[model samples]
Target: MIHVLFVCTGNTCRSPMAAALFNHWAEVMGMSSRVRAGSAGMAALGGEAASEHAVKAMARRGINLAHHRARPVEEAIPKADLVLCMGHGQAQLLRERYPRFAERIHPLMPYAWGLRTDVEDPYGGDLETYEAVAEKLEETVQSVLQKLENSRET
Candidate 1:
């Protein structure tokens, strides 16, 4: 299986949501067995539940985040086939910290959607902020899964 890791500042908001969305979409696209997802935070304290707004936003899309916990990037990166970061700074930090895995690290927007912006963090924001981030993540993760499928085909 191909393991993809999504990274952000705190696993509570963006990364976990992205992983949940990716896993859901992958199963829907019949690629769940081949591609799996995980999430971590560059600065997480570990074991913290996802943000309240994040959980509600995910529930709106029929996805669950109540059981999600925050984890540090160090615990997830080594096993990932691809390390997609929510921001360019996070990607660069991982690349520098794990030079051997530098080639596997990239910003999600640029690599998946060909955009140059960071996936916004909605940590302390309202439900609308989390919803917007989820929408963007949904589109990007689907695009990334398609790219992964194409790469495997080739």
Candidate 2:
């Protein structure tokens, strides 16, 4: 199985949301057996639950983030076949820290959509803000799924 890891600052918002969305879509597309996703934070205190807004926003999309527990980046990186970060800075930092996995580490937007942008963090944002982030993540996740599919065909 191909393990995709989503990384963010705190794992309370963006990364977990992205992971849940990716897993949901992967299963929907019948790729769950071939690929799976997990999430972690660059500096997270392990065990914190996903943010309230994140859980609510995901619920809107029929995806659940209520059970997500924060994890440290180091714990997850070694297992990731591909590590997609929320921004360029995170990607750069991760590459520096885990040089052996540098080739597999990339910023999500540019890698998935060719956009030089960061996935906005909605840590303390309102529900609307969380929703917008979720929409962006959904788009990014769709692109990721397509790329995974294409890779499989080759």
Candidate 3:
């Protein structure tokens, strides 16, 4: 099994969106059995529900994060096979904070989406902004799952 943990600043926007989308993608690709996806944050407070915009954005994709509660990276680090951070800074922070897991930590956009950029947070952004972020997350998640699926063959 492959466990992917998506990380962001607060776990209320980007990471939650990415993780839910990743799970949807896995289900669509018939790879749900082999892939596990979740989200956390660098500075998140525990038990906070996903942002309303995040919930709405996911509803548009038929995925739900209405019940997703924020978790700190510590709770997620030990279980993740791959740690996909929303930006280079987040990845760098993880590398510094937990050097032992450095090898598995990576920037989500550049590595998964080939954007050479970051997935910006839409924490207090409008619905349109959240929708756009969701779209990008879906795109990246597809690529990530595809790469993981391919890797299993070797």
Candidate 4:
């Protein structure tokens, strides 16, 4: 199985959202048994649920993220085969702090085909911003799954 971990500043928002989307995609593609997905935070305020706006935004897409709690990076990194970060800064931070695993870390957008932009944080933003972030994340997740599928076929 391919273990993928998504990381962000706080696990409450972007990372959890990405993990959920990817997990949902994996199931839809009939690859759930081949892929494992999770999320973590670089500097997490643990145990907090996703932002209110984030929860509602995901709900619109039929994704329920209301119960996700923040987790620290150290909690998830060691076992992940691929560690995808939301932005360059998060990737850089991981590389600097854990150079041994740096090669396995990458920006989520780039890892997701066609997307080269960073996934912005929507910590305290309104529903509109959360929705935008969710849309971008869903696009990126599709691309990411494509890449994974391609690699598996090789």
lDDT of 1 by residue, 12-130 (tens): 99999999999999999999999999999999989999999989988998998899989999999999999999999999999999999999999999999788999989988988888
How would you encode candidate 2's per-residue C-alpha lDDT over 1-154 as one tens digit per residue?
A: 9999999999999999999999999999999999999999999999999999999999999987888999999999999999999999999999999999999999999999999999988888899999999999998998998899999999
Q: Comparing 1 and 2 by lDDT, which wins?
A: 2
Q: lDDT for model 4, on a 0 to 1 scale?
A: 0.89
TM-score of candidate 3 against the unseen true structure: 0.97
By descending lDDT, how would the candidates be arranged?
2, 1, 3, 4
Local distance difference test values of all predictions, in order: 0.94, 0.95, 0.91, 0.89
> Which candidate should be chosen as best, given lDDT against the real structure?
2
What is candidate 1's CA lDDT for residue 137?
Answer: 92
Worst 10 residues of 4 by lDDT: 109-118
lDDT of 3 by residue, 1-154 (tens): 8899999999999999999999998999999999989999999999989999999999988887888999999999999989999999999989999999999999998887667899878877899999998888898899998889888888
User: How many clashing pairs in candidate 2?
Assistant: 0
Model 1 sits at a Cα RMSD from the real structure of 0.7
Ranking by TM-score: 2, 1, 3, 4
Candidate 2 off by > 4 Å: none
Query: TM-score for model 4?
Result: 0.95
Output the better candidate (1/2) by TM-score: 2
How many collisions between residues are there in candidate 1? Answer: 0
